[model samples]
Target chain A: QQPVQSPQAVILREGEDAVINCSSSKALYSVHWYRQKHGEAPVFLMILLKGGEQKGHDKISASFNEKKQQSSLYLTASQLSYSGTYFCGTEIRAAGNKLTFGGGTRVLVKP
Target chain B: SAVISQKPSRDICQRGTSLTIQCQVDSQVTMMFWYRQQPGQSLTLIATANQGSEATYESGFVIDKFPISRPNLTFSTLTVSNMSPEDSSIYLCSVGTGPTTGELFFGEGSRLTVL
Candidate 1:
Protein backbone atom coordinates (compact mmCIF):
# COMPACT_ATOMS: atom_id res chain seq x y z
CA GLN A 1 0.00 0.00 0.00
CA GLN A 2 1.09 3.55 -0.68
CA PRO A 3 2.11 5.76 2.20
CA VAL A 4 0.32 9.04 2.89
CA GLN A 5 2.25 12.30 3.04
CA SER A 6 0.83 15.34 4.71
CA PRO A 7 1.09 18.98 3.61
CA GLN A 8 1.51 18.36 -0.09
CA ALA A 9 3.55 21.56 -0.38
CA VAL A 10 5.39 23.92 1.93
CA ILE A 11 7.31 27.16 1.40
CA LEU A 12 10.09 28.23 3.71
CA ARG A 13 12.50 31.07 3.86
CA GLU A 14 16.18 30.65 4.50
CA GLY A 15 17.02 29.67 8.06
CA GLU A 16 13.46 28.41 8.61
CA ASP A 17 12.44 24.91 9.64
CA ALA A 18 9.85 22.45 8.43
CA VAL A 19 8.70 18.89 8.81
CA ILE A 20 7.25 16.35 6.37
CA ASN A 21 5.33 13.40 7.66
CA CYS A 22 4.65 10.01 6.08
CA SER A 23 2.18 7.51 7.41
CA SER A 24 1.43 3.98 6.32
CA SER A 25 -1.58 1.86 7.18
CA LYS A 26 0.37 -1.38 7.05
CA ALA A 27 3.30 -2.26 9.27
CA LEU A 28 6.51 -1.02 7.82
CA TYR A 29 9.83 -2.77 8.00
CA SER A 30 11.71 0.28 6.78
CA VAL A 31 11.09 3.83 5.61
CA HIS A 32 13.29 5.59 3.09
CA TRP A 33 13.44 9.28 2.24
CA TYR A 34 14.33 10.72 -1.13
CA ARG A 35 14.48 14.15 -2.72
CA GLN A 36 14.07 15.07 -6.34
CA LYS A 37 14.55 18.33 -8.13
CA HIS A 38 12.32 19.30 -11.01
CA GLY A 39 13.02 17.16 -14.06
CA GLU A 40 15.54 15.03 -12.17
CA ALA A 41 15.53 11.59 -10.71
CA PRO A 42 15.00 11.11 -6.99
CA VAL A 43 18.08 11.08 -4.74
CA PHE A 44 18.35 8.87 -1.71
CA LEU A 45 18.55 10.72 1.58
CA MET A 46 18.23 8.27 4.50
CA ILE A 47 16.67 5.01 5.55
CA LEU A 48 15.02 4.11 8.86
CA LEU A 49 14.82 0.46 9.86
CA LYS A 50 12.04 -1.31 11.74
CA GLY A 51 13.74 -0.76 15.09
CA GLY A 52 12.25 2.75 15.31
CA GLU A 53 15.49 4.63 14.90
CA GLN A 54 16.40 8.05 13.60
CA LYS A 55 18.91 9.05 10.92
CA GLY A 56 20.51 12.39 10.21
CA HIS A 57 22.15 14.10 7.27
CA ASP A 58 23.60 17.51 7.90
CA LYS A 59 20.66 19.60 9.12
CA ILE A 60 18.16 17.02 7.89
CA SER A 61 16.95 14.31 10.23
CA ALA A 62 14.29 11.62 10.01
CA SER A 63 12.61 9.49 12.67
CA PHE A 64 10.55 6.38 12.26
CA ASN A 65 7.94 5.24 14.77
CA GLU A 66 7.46 1.53 14.58
CA LYS A 67 4.30 1.52 16.65
CA LYS A 68 2.65 4.25 14.61
CA GLN A 69 3.90 3.01 11.25
CA GLN A 70 4.94 6.53 10.47
CA SER A 71 8.03 8.61 9.79
CA SER A 72 8.81 12.31 9.94
CA LEU A 73 11.55 14.28 8.22
CA TYR A 74 12.79 17.46 9.82
CA LEU A 75 14.58 20.21 7.96
CA THR A 76 16.33 22.67 10.23
CA ALA A 77 17.66 26.06 9.12
CA SER A 78 16.56 25.32 5.63
CA GLN A 79 18.64 26.56 2.72
CA LEU A 80 17.85 27.41 -0.86
CA SER A 81 19.32 24.10 -1.90
CA TYR A 82 16.56 22.34 0.02
CA SER A 83 14.00 23.20 -2.62
CA GLY A 84 12.67 19.97 -4.08
CA THR A 85 10.03 17.31 -3.79
CA TYR A 86 10.42 14.82 -0.97
CA PHE A 87 9.11 11.28 -1.12
CA CYS A 88 8.85 8.62 1.54
CA GLY A 89 9.02 5.00 0.46
CA THR A 90 7.79 2.33 2.81
CA GLU A 91 8.73 -1.30 2.92
CA ILE A 92 5.87 -3.37 4.24
CA ARG A 93 6.46 -6.31 6.54
CA ALA A 94 5.43 -8.97 4.03
CA ALA A 95 6.51 -7.15 0.88
CA GLY A 96 10.09 -8.16 0.18
CA ASN A 97 12.16 -6.05 -2.16
CA LYS A 98 9.13 -3.88 -2.86
CA LEU A 99 8.68 -0.30 -1.76
CA THR A 100 5.55 1.84 -1.98
CA PHE A 101 6.25 5.56 -2.19
CA GLY A 102 4.10 8.37 -0.88
CA GLY A 103 2.52 11.02 -3.03
CA GLY A 104 5.34 13.51 -2.16
CA THR A 105 5.84 16.87 -0.47
CA ARG A 106 7.10 19.80 -2.47
CA VAL A 107 9.37 22.10 -0.50
CA LEU A 108 10.41 25.51 -1.73
CA VAL A 109 13.01 27.43 0.18
CA LYS A 110 13.49 30.99 -0.90
CA PRO A 111 16.13 33.44 0.18
CA SER B 1 26.63 3.10 -2.38
CA ALA B 2 26.49 2.35 -6.08
CA VAL B 3 27.07 4.65 -9.04
CA ILE B 4 24.30 4.14 -11.57
CA SER B 5 24.36 5.34 -15.16
CA GLN B 6 21.48 5.52 -17.63
CA LYS B 7 21.54 6.10 -21.36
CA PRO B 8 19.52 8.50 -23.51
CA SER B 9 18.77 10.99 -20.79
CA ARG B 10 15.91 12.28 -22.96
CA ASP B 11 14.43 11.04 -26.20
CA ILE B 12 11.59 11.81 -28.58
CA CYS B 13 10.09 8.87 -30.38
CA GLN B 14 7.11 8.12 -32.61
CA ARG B 15 4.06 6.23 -31.49
CA GLY B 16 4.83 2.95 -33.18
CA THR B 17 8.53 2.88 -32.35
CA SER B 18 10.14 1.09 -29.43
CA LEU B 19 12.88 2.46 -27.22
CA THR B 20 15.21 0.59 -24.92
CA ILE B 21 16.68 2.25 -21.85
CA GLN B 22 19.88 0.89 -20.39
CA CYS B 23 21.06 0.92 -16.78
CA GLN B 24 24.59 0.23 -15.60
CA VAL B 25 25.85 -0.05 -12.06
CA ASP B 26 29.41 0.43 -10.91
CA SER B 27 29.33 -2.47 -8.46
CA GLN B 28 27.63 -5.83 -8.65
CA VAL B 29 24.12 -5.96 -7.23
CA THR B 30 21.70 -8.80 -6.62
CA MET B 31 18.55 -7.13 -7.92
CA MET B 32 17.76 -4.13 -10.10
CA PHE B 33 14.36 -2.47 -10.32
CA TRP B 34 12.59 -0.33 -12.91
CA TYR B 35 10.22 2.49 -12.04
CA ARG B 36 8.05 4.91 -13.96
CA GLN B 37 7.07 8.43 -13.00
CA GLN B 38 4.51 10.35 -14.97
CA PRO B 39 4.49 14.11 -15.07
CA GLY B 40 3.89 15.48 -11.59
CA GLN B 41 3.25 12.01 -10.16
CA SER B 42 4.87 9.65 -7.71
CA LEU B 43 7.20 6.90 -8.75
CA THR B 44 5.62 3.51 -9.47
CA LEU B 45 7.51 0.24 -9.52
CA ILE B 46 7.52 -1.38 -12.94
CA ALA B 47 9.36 -4.59 -12.31
CA THR B 48 12.23 -6.37 -10.58
CA ALA B 49 15.05 -7.52 -12.83
CA ASN B 50 16.78 -10.73 -11.81
CA GLN B 51 20.01 -11.88 -13.28
CA GLY B 52 19.80 -14.82 -15.69
CA SER B 53 16.04 -15.08 -15.20
CA GLU B 54 12.79 -13.45 -16.19
CA ALA B 55 11.81 -10.13 -14.69
CA THR B 56 8.78 -9.75 -12.44
CA TYR B 57 6.30 -7.09 -13.44
CA GLU B 58 4.27 -5.10 -11.00
CA SER B 59 0.52 -4.62 -10.97
CA GLY B 60 -0.75 -2.75 -14.05
CA PHE B 61 2.56 -3.42 -15.80
CA VAL B 62 3.27 -6.34 -18.09
CA ILE B 63 6.38 -7.98 -19.50
CA ASP B 64 4.99 -7.76 -23.00
CA LYS B 65 4.70 -3.97 -22.88
CA PHE B 66 7.91 -3.38 -20.94
CA PRO B 67 10.39 -6.12 -21.62
CA ILE B 68 13.37 -6.22 -19.27
CA SER B 69 16.74 -7.86 -19.55
CA ARG B 70 19.26 -8.39 -16.78
CA PRO B 71 22.16 -9.93 -18.62
CA ASN B 72 24.42 -9.63 -15.59
CA LEU B 73 24.58 -8.19 -12.11
CA THR B 74 25.89 -4.80 -13.20
CA PHE B 75 23.67 -4.16 -16.20
CA SER B 76 19.98 -4.17 -17.11
CA THR B 77 17.76 -2.81 -19.85
CA LEU B 78 14.04 -1.92 -20.03
CA THR B 79 12.46 -1.62 -23.43
CA VAL B 80 9.24 0.28 -23.93
CA SER B 81 7.30 -1.52 -26.60
CA ASN B 82 4.99 0.20 -29.09
CA MET B 83 5.16 3.57 -27.49
CA SER B 84 2.25 5.97 -27.19
CA PRO B 85 1.50 9.33 -25.66
CA GLU B 86 0.67 7.66 -22.38
CA ASP B 87 4.11 6.07 -22.33
CA SER B 88 5.76 9.45 -22.15
CA SER B 89 7.29 9.47 -18.73
CA ILE B 90 10.56 9.32 -16.88
CA TYR B 91 11.86 5.81 -16.39
CA LEU B 92 14.27 5.13 -13.56
CA CYS B 93 16.42 2.16 -12.61
CA SER B 94 17.43 1.39 -9.06
CA VAL B 95 19.34 -1.28 -7.19
CA GLY B 96 19.14 -2.30 -3.57
CA THR B 97 22.29 -3.30 -1.76
CA GLY B 98 20.41 -6.27 -0.31
CA PRO B 99 16.94 -7.57 0.53
CA THR B 100 16.96 -6.55 4.20
CA THR B 101 16.39 -2.80 4.57
CA GLY B 102 14.93 -2.11 1.14
CA GLU B 103 17.34 0.78 0.76
CA LEU B 104 18.02 1.58 -2.87
CA PHE B 105 20.21 3.76 -5.09
CA PHE B 106 18.71 5.26 -8.24
CA GLY B 107 19.94 6.36 -11.61
CA GLU B 108 19.43 9.81 -13.05
CA GLY B 109 16.56 8.58 -15.25
CA SER B 110 15.60 8.48 -18.91
CA ARG B 111 12.87 10.84 -20.07
CA LEU B 112 10.83 9.63 -22.99
CA THR B 113 8.49 11.78 -25.05
CA VAL B 114 6.20 9.81 -27.25
CA LEU B 115 4.81 11.62 -30.23
Candidate 2:
Protein backbone atom coordinates (compact mmCIF):
# COMPACT_ATOMS: atom_id res chain seq x y z
CA GLN A 1 0.00 0.00 0.00
CA GLN A 2 1.08 3.61 -0.57
CA PRO A 3 2.29 5.66 2.38
CA VAL A 4 0.11 8.41 3.89
CA GLN A 5 1.35 12.00 4.20
CA SER A 6 -0.17 14.48 6.62
CA PRO A 7 -1.07 18.16 6.18
CA GLN A 8 -2.04 18.05 2.54
CA ALA A 9 -0.99 21.66 2.24
CA VAL A 10 0.95 24.19 4.27
CA ILE A 11 1.75 27.86 3.81
CA LEU A 12 4.86 29.15 5.51
CA ARG A 13 6.44 32.55 5.66
CA GLU A 14 10.15 33.20 5.34
CA GLY A 15 12.13 31.93 8.35
CA GLU A 16 9.24 29.81 9.60
CA ASP A 17 9.43 26.08 10.37
CA ALA A 18 7.20 23.20 9.27
CA VAL A 19 7.15 19.45 9.56
CA ILE A 20 5.72 16.84 7.17
CA ASN A 21 4.98 13.35 8.35
CA CYS A 22 4.63 10.03 6.55
CA SER A 23 3.26 6.77 7.90
CA SER A 24 3.25 3.31 6.37
CA SER A 25 1.43 0.13 7.27
CA LYS A 26 4.09 -2.30 6.11
CA ALA A 27 7.72 -2.60 7.13
CA LEU A 28 9.93 -0.10 5.38
CA TYR A 29 13.60 -0.56 4.64
CA SER A 30 14.10 3.05 3.68
CA VAL A 31 12.26 6.33 3.17
CA HIS A 32 13.22 8.71 0.36
CA TRP A 33 12.27 12.36 0.24
CA TYR A 34 11.81 14.43 -2.92
CA ARG A 35 10.84 18.01 -3.72
CA GLN A 36 9.10 18.99 -6.95
CA LYS A 37 8.68 22.55 -8.06
CA HIS A 38 5.96 23.81 -10.34
CA GLY A 39 6.28 22.38 -13.86
CA GLU A 40 9.47 20.47 -13.02
CA ALA A 41 10.53 16.95 -12.22
CA PRO A 42 10.87 15.81 -8.65
CA VAL A 43 14.34 16.27 -7.16
CA PHE A 44 15.90 13.94 -4.64
CA LEU A 45 16.28 15.47 -1.22
CA MET A 46 17.27 12.79 1.28
CA ILE A 47 16.98 9.14 2.18
CA LEU A 48 16.77 7.53 5.61
CA LEU A 49 17.66 3.88 5.94
CA LYS A 50 16.10 1.32 8.24
CA GLY A 51 19.26 0.92 10.31
CA GLY A 52 19.67 4.70 10.80
CA GLU A 53 21.93 5.34 7.79
CA GLN A 54 21.09 8.61 6.07
CA LYS A 55 22.23 10.17 2.80
CA GLY A 56 21.57 13.38 0.93
CA HIS A 57 22.20 17.12 1.24
CA ASP A 58 23.31 18.34 4.66
CA LYS A 59 20.67 21.05 4.80
CA ILE A 60 17.85 18.57 4.39
CA SER A 61 16.85 17.18 7.78
CA ALA A 62 14.66 14.08 8.17
CA SER A 63 14.05 11.20 10.58
CA PHE A 64 12.84 7.63 10.23
CA ASN A 65 11.41 5.66 13.14
CA GLU A 66 11.44 1.99 12.11
CA LYS A 67 9.59 0.71 15.13
CA LYS A 68 6.65 2.98 14.36
CA GLN A 69 7.08 2.79 10.57
CA GLN A 70 6.98 6.55 10.27
CA SER A 71 9.16 9.30 8.82
CA SER A 72 9.22 13.05 9.34
CA LEU A 73 10.75 15.78 7.21
CA TYR A 74 11.66 18.96 9.00
CA LEU A 75 11.88 22.24 7.12
CA THR A 76 13.67 24.82 9.27
CA ALA A 77 13.92 28.49 8.43
CA SER A 78 11.96 27.98 5.29
CA GLN A 79 12.96 29.92 2.25
CA LEU A 80 11.20 30.81 -0.97
CA SER A 81 13.10 28.04 -2.69
CA TYR A 82 11.32 25.62 -0.36
CA SER A 83 8.01 26.31 -2.06
CA GLY A 84 7.06 23.05 -3.73
CA THR A 85 5.47 19.65 -3.19
CA TYR A 86 7.22 17.10 -0.98
CA PHE A 87 6.81 13.38 -1.46
CA CYS A 88 8.02 10.47 0.60
CA GLY A 89 8.87 7.19 -1.14
CA THR A 90 8.95 4.07 0.98
CA GLU A 91 10.93 0.98 0.13
CA ILE A 92 9.92 -2.37 1.54
CA ARG A 93 13.02 -4.43 0.78
CA ALA A 94 16.77 -4.06 0.91
CA ALA A 95 18.17 -2.96 -2.44
CA GLY A 96 14.61 -2.70 -3.70
CA ASN A 97 14.67 0.07 -6.23
CA LYS A 98 10.87 0.10 -6.44
CA LEU A 99 9.25 2.78 -4.27
CA THR A 100 5.69 3.73 -3.46
CA PHE A 101 5.42 7.48 -3.11
CA GLY A 102 3.16 9.28 -0.64
CA GLY A 103 0.23 11.53 -1.50
CA GLY A 104 2.61 14.50 -1.49
CA THR A 105 2.59 17.56 0.76
CA ARG A 106 2.25 20.93 -0.87
CA VAL A 107 4.38 23.62 0.77
CA LEU A 108 4.19 27.26 -0.14
CA VAL A 109 6.87 29.49 1.36
CA LYS A 110 5.95 33.13 1.16
CA PRO A 111 8.16 36.16 1.37
CA SER B 1 22.66 11.27 -10.15
CA ALA B 2 21.56 10.88 -13.79
CA VAL B 3 20.15 13.29 -16.33
CA ILE B 4 16.94 12.02 -17.90
CA SER B 5 15.16 13.30 -20.98
CA GLN B 6 11.56 12.44 -21.79
CA LYS B 7 10.10 13.04 -25.24
CA PRO B 8 6.91 14.92 -26.11
CA SER B 9 6.74 17.08 -23.01
CA ARG B 10 3.02 17.45 -23.64
CA ASP B 11 0.59 15.99 -26.13
CA ILE B 12 -3.11 16.00 -26.95
CA CYS B 13 -4.55 12.72 -28.10
CA GLN B 14 -7.99 11.45 -28.93
CA ARG B 15 -9.71 8.48 -27.43
CA GLY B 16 -8.78 5.01 -28.78
CA THR B 17 -5.33 6.14 -29.90
CA SER B 18 -2.01 5.27 -28.36
CA LEU B 19 0.89 7.41 -27.20
CA THR B 20 4.44 6.27 -26.60
CA ILE B 21 6.69 8.19 -24.25
CA GLN B 22 10.47 7.80 -24.52
CA CYS B 23 12.98 8.23 -21.76
CA GLN B 24 16.71 8.55 -22.27
CA VAL B 25 19.23 8.70 -19.47
CA ASP B 26 22.66 10.24 -19.85
CA SER B 27 24.26 7.59 -17.67
CA GLN B 28 23.44 3.91 -17.59
CA VAL B 29 21.54 3.02 -14.44
CA THR B 30 20.85 -0.29 -12.75
CA MET B 31 17.08 0.23 -12.34
CA MET B 32 14.46 2.36 -14.08
CA PHE B 33 10.83 2.95 -13.18
CA TRP B 34 7.73 4.62 -14.61
CA TYR B 35 5.14 6.53 -12.59
CA ARG B 36 1.82 8.23 -13.28
CA GLN B 37 0.46 11.33 -11.58
CA GLN B 38 -3.11 12.25 -12.28
CA PRO B 39 -4.56 15.73 -12.08
CA GLY B 40 -4.23 17.01 -8.50
CA GLN B 41 -3.30 13.59 -7.20
CA SER B 42 -0.29 11.68 -5.94
CA LEU B 43 2.08 9.58 -7.97
CA THR B 44 1.36 5.92 -8.66
CA LEU B 45 3.93 3.34 -9.68
CA ILE B 46 3.21 1.99 -13.16
CA ALA B 47 6.02 -0.50 -13.67
CA THR B 48 9.74 -1.25 -13.46
CA ALA B 49 11.64 -1.46 -16.73
CA ASN B 50 14.10 -4.31 -16.50
CA GLN B 51 17.02 -4.41 -18.88
CA GLY B 52 17.03 -7.40 -21.24
CA SER B 53 13.75 -8.67 -19.79
CA GLU B 54 10.06 -7.93 -19.62
CA ALA B 55 8.92 -5.08 -17.40
CA THR B 56 7.46 -5.75 -13.99
CA TYR B 57 4.13 -4.01 -13.56
CA GLU B 58 2.49 -3.05 -10.31
CA SER B 59 -0.92 -4.11 -9.10
CA GLY B 60 -3.88 -2.74 -11.10
CA PHE B 61 -1.57 -2.30 -14.10
CA VAL B 62 -1.11 -4.68 -17.01
CA ILE B 63 1.32 -4.99 -19.89
CA ASP B 64 -1.30 -5.06 -22.60
CA LYS B 65 -2.68 -1.71 -21.61
CA PHE B 66 0.69 -0.15 -20.93
CA PRO B 67 3.43 -1.77 -22.99
CA ILE B 68 6.98 -1.08 -21.87
CA SER B 69 10.32 -1.58 -23.55
CA ARG B 70 13.76 -1.40 -22.04
CA PRO B 71 16.02 -1.71 -25.05
CA ASN B 72 19.05 -0.98 -22.90
CA LEU B 73 20.07 0.38 -19.56
CA THR B 74 19.93 3.99 -20.72
CA PHE B 75 16.71 4.04 -22.73
CA SER B 76 13.13 2.94 -22.13
CA THR B 77 9.68 3.50 -23.58
CA LEU B 78 6.14 3.30 -22.23
CA THR B 79 3.16 3.01 -24.56
CA VAL B 80 -0.37 3.82 -23.47
CA SER B 81 -2.57 1.68 -25.62
CA ASN B 82 -6.23 2.34 -26.46
CA MET B 83 -6.19 5.57 -24.60
CA SER B 84 -9.09 7.03 -22.70
CA PRO B 85 -9.77 10.19 -20.76
CA GLU B 86 -8.82 8.47 -17.55
CA ASP B 87 -5.44 7.59 -19.06
CA SER B 88 -4.49 11.23 -19.25
CA SER B 89 -1.80 11.98 -16.70
CA ILE B 90 1.81 13.00 -16.31
CA TYR B 91 4.04 10.05 -17.01
CA LEU B 92 7.44 10.30 -15.40
CA CYS B 93 10.59 8.28 -16.07
CA SER B 94 13.00 7.78 -13.22
CA VAL B 95 16.38 6.08 -12.89
CA GLY B 96 17.39 4.64 -9.58
CA THR B 97 20.61 5.95 -8.06
CA GLY B 98 20.98 3.62 -5.11
CA PRO B 99 19.93 0.00 -4.75
CA THR B 100 19.71 0.11 -0.96
CA THR B 101 18.76 3.74 -0.41
CA GLY B 102 16.36 3.87 -3.40
CA GLU B 103 17.24 7.31 -4.72
CA LEU B 104 15.53 7.94 -8.07
CA PHE B 105 16.31 10.61 -10.65
CA PHE B 106 13.24 11.61 -12.66
CA GLY B 107 12.69 13.01 -16.11
CA GLU B 108 10.75 16.14 -16.93
CA GLY B 109 7.69 13.96 -17.56
CA SER B 110 5.35 13.68 -20.54
CA ARG B 111 2.01 15.32 -19.95
CA LEU B 112 -0.86 13.69 -21.82
CA THR B 113 -4.23 15.26 -22.36
CA VAL B 114 -6.70 12.80 -23.81
CA LEU B 115 -9.98 14.12 -25.15
Per-candidate DockQ versus the true complex? 0.62, 0.73
True contacts kept of 2: 0.80
- Which regions of candidate 2 deviate over 4 angstroms? A51-58
Clashing pairs in 2: none
Q: What is the per-residue lDDT of model 2 for residues A69-110, given as tens digits with 9 covering 90 to 100? A: 999998888889999999999888875668888999999999
Q: What TM-score does chain A of each model score against the native chain A?
A: 0.95, 0.92
**lDDT by residue (tens digit), candidate 2, B1-115:** 7999999899999999999999999988888999999877778999999999999999999999999999998999999999999999999998986554556899999999999
Stretches of candidate 1 above 4 Å error? A94-97
TM-score of each: 0.95, 0.95
State each model's TM-score restricted to chain B.
0.97, 0.97
lDDT of 1 by residue, A39-61 (tens): 87788899888556999999999
